[model samples]
Target: MTTSTTTPLQRWKTFFADRSSVVSGIITLVVVVLTLISYTGFLQAVERRSGVVFVDSIHRILGPIDVTWPTFVVLYASLILALGVLLTRPEHLFRTLRAYSILVGIRVICMALLPLDPPMTTIPLHDPFVALFTSSEHSTLTKDLFFSGHTATLALLALSMPTRSLRIVFILSTTALATFTVLQHVHYTVDVIVAPMAALLAFVLNRGFAAENQ
Candidate 1:
């Protein structure tokens, strides 16, 4: 009998060939898509309501700047890089997706419980990609504050990386993204500060869930 060599392509094919793996991937993707769509609707509704604005000592010190381009640059580039790495490891990709979906659900709950208006010195963030899905009037959202979604997303990506080098790179990228969000005043200091903690909670929960299934 001749032995067969396992290549990267063969491994990927084998992964997809497993019915359980395929089902899990489909479920995760559906959950993520639904979570995102729900978040968009919630954001638009929250934008219509008014909330209290408070003073943040940190925001007072740094003030607001228009760092929109730089913010998206780091955010999207890091996401692309993380996806490139995670795709090679299909399991990691699924883990990241589940964690991210959990993160968004957490954010929605927190935002619902604590409605917040943007900072008094807020420089509105303009995301071109998000604009595509929203109406012109609802394009710039300011009330989805509690925790920073941008920061949490990058933090989740960092935690989900399968390698030390990738983790380090994502950690730095997350830090930069957090700084950019705060500098832009698109999020309050507390928002960015709590983001990593929220992300960690999601990551830990996802890991536990996966472990139980295993």
Candidate 2:
């Protein structure tokens, strides 16, 4: 009987192992982890400053937004997981992730530098949706203006898509979400407007970086 020899499949493994890809992946992961830690710390500091300790305040602001909470959670989780998977293949993931990392870092920095008081300070909630800003015992890390996480998160998801159609869909869907947040008085008008711009800034930064490297 003749022995059959199995050819080695080395090319597939080598596909994403280029120098740029590896460097970019490492940078992205470092940024993601560090930024998250910093973000949590920032929020904690905000809480400390505000002096409010009741968890109900958190729920009050969030309850109205919960109208689409499940959807947001699923979408956000998928985006993050997708990034992780892409990282496994650095060649495909590096540039994109790097760009996103920049966005995240930028947002955090902006928030830290300009912490805003949330609307809860002034609005009173007669109902779940109608709750205006209530006074918080503790201050938050960031102010209510300069950006909107919901909008930015939605926009980030949209911008992550390479195709135009998906981006447009994300923009539209997030717009609706933003509208709901405003109608419910969860966010100020400025916050909703700023979110999209922040996302756009990310897109431009990513493109510029990619071009510079190429």
Candidate 3:
């Protein structure tokens, strides 16, 4: 049988035929928006009330370590690639996205309660990245210190993925990124640990929500 062309609205309705698909998509978007709000608020609060004295103190101890630009770039690239690949299947996409959302939300909650400063600002490191991390205008978003956001995001992406290979890649990429964060003095040992913990907590919440909905 020949098919007649459908209008854009009709096509949209057909595409979202499953109520679950549409509802999940909306819920996912809501979760994302909430996380963004929490993140932005946490950063602003920290910038207004805190200083870099603690980070400066830590820098005195870690200033001797040297990290190259190329290494940091490679680590960042690997992290993006791993997360990109895992976020692709439609079947698990919403669930995975929600998990990521929860992870960021958790981090924001932690940061709001316990704002930690990066070593660069507190230590007054001379590195370009350090300056960026420490500057009030530039560092506002990056200075929230409950955990490494990138590391936790990478970890959540990996943990929520179903495939073993993807999980392995996620673990490897997150580890590399976390290592870079610590070595670069962008985050502390506690932040690295919290990244995985945040992901784990998100995963648990995601699973519970999914089951309840089912």
Instruction: Give each prediction's root-mean-square deviation over alpha carbons.
Output: 3.0, 9.7, 6.8
Tell me the tens digit of each residue's lDDT in model 2 across 35-100.
Answer: 666665555565444322222343344444434454445445555655554444334455556656
lDDT of 1: 0.87
- Give candidate 3 misplaced runs (Cα > 4 Å): 1-15, 51-87, 120-136, 139-142
- Of 2 and 3, the candidate ranking higher by lDDT: 3
> What C-alpha lDDT does candidate 2 achieve relative to the native structure?
0.56
- Clash pairs for candidate 1: none
The Cα local distance difference test for each model comes to 0.87, 0.56, 0.65
Question: Which lDDT tens digits does candidate 1 get at residues 52-131?
Answer: 79888888888588888888889889988987887777777888999999999999999999989999899999888777
| Highest TM-score scorer | 1
Give the top-scoring candidate (lDDT): 1
